[model samples]
Target: MDITVYRPGELTAADRAAWAHVQSQAVAMGSPQLGNPFLSPGFTFAVAHHHRGVRVAVVREEGEPVAFFPFQRSAAGVGRAIGLGLSDCQGLVHRPGFQWDARELLRACGLAVWEFDHLVEGQKPFEEGATGTYASPVMDVEHGYEAYLGHLRSHSPKFVRTTLAKERKLGRDVGEVRYVHDERDVGALRTLMGWKSAQYRRTGRSDRFARPWIVDLVEHLFHTREESFSGLLSVLYAGDRPIAAHFGMRTPAVLACWFPAYDPQFSKYSPGLVLHLRMAEGAAADGVAHLDLGRGHKEYKESLKTRDLTVSEGWVTRPHPVALGHRARRAPVRALRNAVTAHPVLREPADRFLKRVGRLRAGAR
Candidate 1:
């Protein structure tokens, strides 16, 4: 086997085709997450446009590409899965039974340590590197949106009725409801970022939209359209006003829920839920088989998820002084965060503290 590293844009037509072939083979591995849109080359291409640090490792067997690994290298030689925080599925998209040493792979990329928070489970090379695993919720909608609604009606009947009724009520009270599964309005995108940023600060979490690179990346992707991967902007509008929206990525078979927000003033109308229900309807109609809500827990995720996938979080480090130094710098904070997230009792208190801090920050501002 041979390995070569290059920027995402450096890939030739053959390289892209080989990458897609390998990714398609991944679906036979038999899990929805393995087929996530984030793992596709189109995503890497968009990120490469905004981030020079992005790199891809093409692993070949007998001169044929068998796998692809995309990551970002920081100045200190520490690496992270490309679009770590923003990407829900992370792994070396490869053919089944492919063998490679994680350490060797890192060395070839000149990375001392490779960190991943949403590593797809069953990735053998990094199996021993995981510090923990978490559930990633998903909704299998291959059977169509109505079938899913039937499941919801049998389970969370109230949730389905309330959301549907809210959609009707919102339409009647405000104006005719309009939904665009692929909205191209730039203003709607900015509104989503603003709402997401304010929500992050109000909840005492770091606002990702505050980072210019992330903003640029999203903007770049929003304009990108491809068969394997494309940016999807779903918006719910009342008359001429946007009320709820979601910006995510979708492959022909899967859609990833990334940033979703709604007008707080319409919170009583449950526009967020209405938007998601519409999203599912749109996805099913488009032949999208699954919707990945991503790794982590939330009431909405629990209420809507039909299944779960295991995603790992940890770092794979090659034995070196730089690796040790990086580990020492990050381990404590990572461990504390993992502990809090793993324990609901602790997480609740931590959440409350963060919200209080957020309130103080808002007051100061």
Candidate 2:
């Protein structure tokens, strides 16, 4: 086996094709993180544009590509999965049953430590890393929206009942209910961004829309489509006006939920929740079994989750003084995080503080 690293903007068509081939093999691969145009070249471009030390590692056997890893080195020599905050999954992509040692990969990249937060569970490279329990609620949408709703009512009666009632009230009071499963309207994407930016500000969080690359990347994804993974924009309308919208990606088997927003005017109707229920129905019909609600402990997540999986954020360090020092500094922080996350009361304050800090930083920028 031979390993080669390519700088961002240096990936040839062959490289992109090989990467896409590997991505298609991964069962959990979603559009925004892997298949979507924005997440593909866009992520690499963002890292390169910002001088964030992006690189791709290809492991080839007999001149045939076997694995690929996308990473970015920080100023301190720490290598992290590219688009860490924005991407839902992070790790090497390899052929099934083909194994590449994580230690070897890190050494080849000259990284002191390799870190990830949203590694898809069962990706062997991250098996030994410290992990924590997280859940992404999904609704089986194969049998259609109505059937899925019936299942929801059976599984989470109170939540389904309340949400349906709210949805009805919303339509009766505001406008007639309508749903567009695969809306091609670009204007709706802009509306979602506007709503999302406001939601971020109101909740004391950073508005990702401020970043031109992030905004442009999302728009690019909205327009681009692929067979293995495709961008999906779902909208709920009340009297011909879009009240809730979701922008996500779908693979053959999974719908990876990303940005979701709704009109504040329809907040009382819980349009966002209504949009998700509809998304689930659409996903199931499309042969998608999982709706990745993503990592976080929100009220809706709790209500919708059927099972929980574990993910992690930790690093394996090289035998270097700088790496050791980095680990030492991060240990206490990680411990504190674990402790707080284990306790709801402690976690809320920390979440609030982080959100406030994010907002302050965004405002300053």
TM-scores of the candidates are 0.95, 0.85
The sequence of per-residue lDDT tens digits that candidate 2 reaches over residues 105-131 is 888888888777676556666667644
Which consecutive 10 residues in model 1 have the weakest lDDT in total?
A: 26-35
Off by over 4 Å in 1: 28-31
Q: lDDT values of the candidates?
A: 0.89, 0.74
Model 2 alpha-carbon miss at residue 298, Å:
1.2
Q: What would the per-residue lDDT of candidate 1 be over residues 1-365, giving only the tens digit for each residue?
A: 58999987789988998887778777766644567888999888888888769999999888989889999998889998888778898989888778789999999999999999899877878867888889999887899999988888988999898888988999999999999999999889999999889999999999999999899989988988877788999999998799999999998778999999988888989898899988999999999998999988788998888888889988899988888998798789989988898799999999999999999999998
- Candidate 2, residue 207: the lDDT equals 81
Q: How close is candidate 1 to the true structure, as a TM-score?
A: 0.95
Candidate 2 — which pairs collide?
A: 141-284, 141-285, 142-284, 142-285
State, as a TM-score between 0 and 1, how close model 2 is to the true structure: 0.85
Best by TM-score: 1
